[model samples]
Target: MLALTNATVITGDGRTLLARATVLAADGRITGLRAGSGVPAGARVLDLEGDYLLPGFINSHVHGVTFGPLFASGAPPLAEEAIRRNLVRHLAAGTTTVLSVDGFALPEEVAEAQHLSPLTIKTSAGLTPAALTAAQAVDGAGLTERHLAASLKEQVEAGAVAIGEAGSGHTLGGGGSEYMYIPRRIKEETGVEISPAQARALKEAALGKELDPAARDEAALQAALAGAGLAGRLTPARAQALIAACVLPGLKPARRSIAEAAATARHFGLPLIAHTAPPSLAAVLAAARAGTRTIAAHTNHDSFTAGAMLAAARALKRAGAILDGATFDSFGARRTTESPANLVTLLKAGLVDLITTDYGGGFFDPLPLALKAIVGAGILPLPAAVRLLTAAPAAALPGLAPERGRIAPGYIADLTVLARADLARVRYVFIGGRQVFSSEVTSGITSSSDV
Candidate 1:
């Protein structure tokens, strides 16, 4: 048995916080939690010295940790070492469970990677080619409806948990793509290479009108194109087409591909995860209406202004769909669509249903850091913030809710220990009742007792 004492336990359920408590675990399950120093004799005890104990964070949306190419450059699948390193980073950041969104990696490969890590890893079925292209417009790799359905079935049979990240703009430069692929593609086509900042500026100029590509300012578009060295090389029409293709791909067809994918996911009894942006709201709603339990991923994505995000969030909530807020590389800097202020707006308004890190544009925003920031900003209470990362995500995904994401007895003994002064400073991580990580080993009485 393992006994953890001298801690303030925030039990991820949004209503429990046992100050100076004792948590007991045995056989990979939480046996009990009670007030203070109730260690059973012969149990190994680690005195946390008043640190904050939390249920391990559960990340509902992640990519590039297993089977996906790195955010840009079309690099090869991440190597085993790279995946392990990413897992370690997540563990160090207090993430004990992660749902890796779709990519090229097989379900079996994702399972193998999970087997090697102490973190509880889950995988989603890969995306259809049309959906894939809509997100990024990659050449080739389109899938027929038949093939897409078959693949999703196969993955579900192979233990896949969800059908996710149904669409994204990263590949097409809708959100963070401006930092990478969009500029690369522009340069490839017109020999006009642009910087990441310029790409972001262009994305704002083209997509700022919210689903109305025709509302784009021609002069501004020309200036952005010229600033990227596209002057005289590409017509304004062609430039607008490129921008539209990147930011609003397939929306013109009324998001047929997204609806189809969502229907297929519903057929398989899996929740459909779709990218959430102004232009994609219709698709998200379509999926929800199609009877798929849809998750509007990154509802506060940078593409939408704060007002638009709140409105969309309320609508998604009313639709009985889940609203996922990703802390996309919003650690110390606002690197991607996720800003602390935006996330705060959602949280304060009670619009965010779950929290995750969607690749964080390759930086993989640390959940704890984001949580700490929100809590410190006085935007959200600590216990409520913990639930968004834990119970909320676990509940959002049926596969994880019952077994993990809580500190109550019979729950999986996945726990994170944070320093009292710095909530982001994870000091220890326990997975399945095993001490998988520790910043420092402390002396404790033990021999036959499990640690």
Candidate 2:
């Protein structure tokens, strides 16, 4: 048995607290959580000097791409190793679980390129995107399509648990408005013109190559929607495309999205994860209308009134759907709050359903999740910040809410020991009942940047 004494236990399970308390864990699961005067007998006690013992964070939408900053040029990075490093980094930041997507170098050859470079070089200076220029940095490259699929399958093969942040819902130009409108002249001067007709033709061709006759047909339809404006007017092509893509925002039918996400989930039994921003509400609602129980990673950014939230909730309810919350990190110091605090906005609206980090947000740590709650959500207490991250999402996903994300009896041993300085702090961290990181270890041999 392992016992931690003198720790301020934040049992993320909604208001359960143990001041200067002791926690016991056995067999990698929390066996006991309560307030006691001294350490339990026969337990290996680790003395914590009034630090916070909370559930390890579960970030639902962190990107492997965040490491792109650390990488330069060379071969595609070592994805698994980079992921491990990121996991360790998240651990140090009090995050125990993370959901990663995108920024993996594609083309199966990139994986081989990874094996060619030094661990530091490959892990930091990722393998370059072939068929491109040399000497430029773009964070991390995405995994080859085949490799991403294989990686997902590998998670299954390796008995790693599944959590979906698929990020497949929206494409680059799909957002339409608010995207940096690169007018035709810039492309023309660069000899890179993305004509709607050409884009349509290419999409049609790609669809035909997909072998899924239905999707191919849908792709052709999507091309048409692109050619015509999404909201300007519904031309025949727009109607047909909407029918084909089946993912039009607001008033769109939900068949296409339903079919696609269902196929993905069946293959992996993973949940459909949707990232809903203020503008993407309509499309997200359309998806929910299609009978998908998706995780709404960041539906917290709701616009005032029911125009957005109501449409989505109604559609989701009609489809018998549920979703998860994503507390996205506010841009560094741009916003007053951290990400998790954003929950109070939803919570005040009585929308506190599912909550998780859009982990590996543009900023660092689960602390942002907590800080956002205080600032964005107009909250002041630290305990409340803790629950939004731990309990809310736990109630959403299985094998999670009750078992992990908190300091409690009969819970998973995964926990984060954090030192606080107003909004941010770092002393040491523990994961799965082991001291996985310490500032002391990070001090001598290596710079803490990679941790």
Judging by lDDT against the true structure, name the best candidate.
1
lDDT of 2 by residue, 336-410 (tens): 123333445455554545455443223333554355435444543556667766665555555333467777677
lDDT of 1 by residue, 1-451 (tens): 8888888999998878889998999999999999967678788888889999999999888776775443322235667787888888888888888888754446656767876677888877755555544433442232333333455567678777777666565543355566656776688788777866577666666655464665777678778877877778878777666766655544443255567668778788878888787667888987886678988888888767889888888888878889988888776545554356677789889888899988755676778888888889887889988999999988888875458899999999999998889988888899888888888766443533454
The most accurate candidate by TM-score is 1
Query: What TM-score does candidate 2 get on C-alpha atoms?
Result: 0.59
lDDT of each: 0.74, 0.45
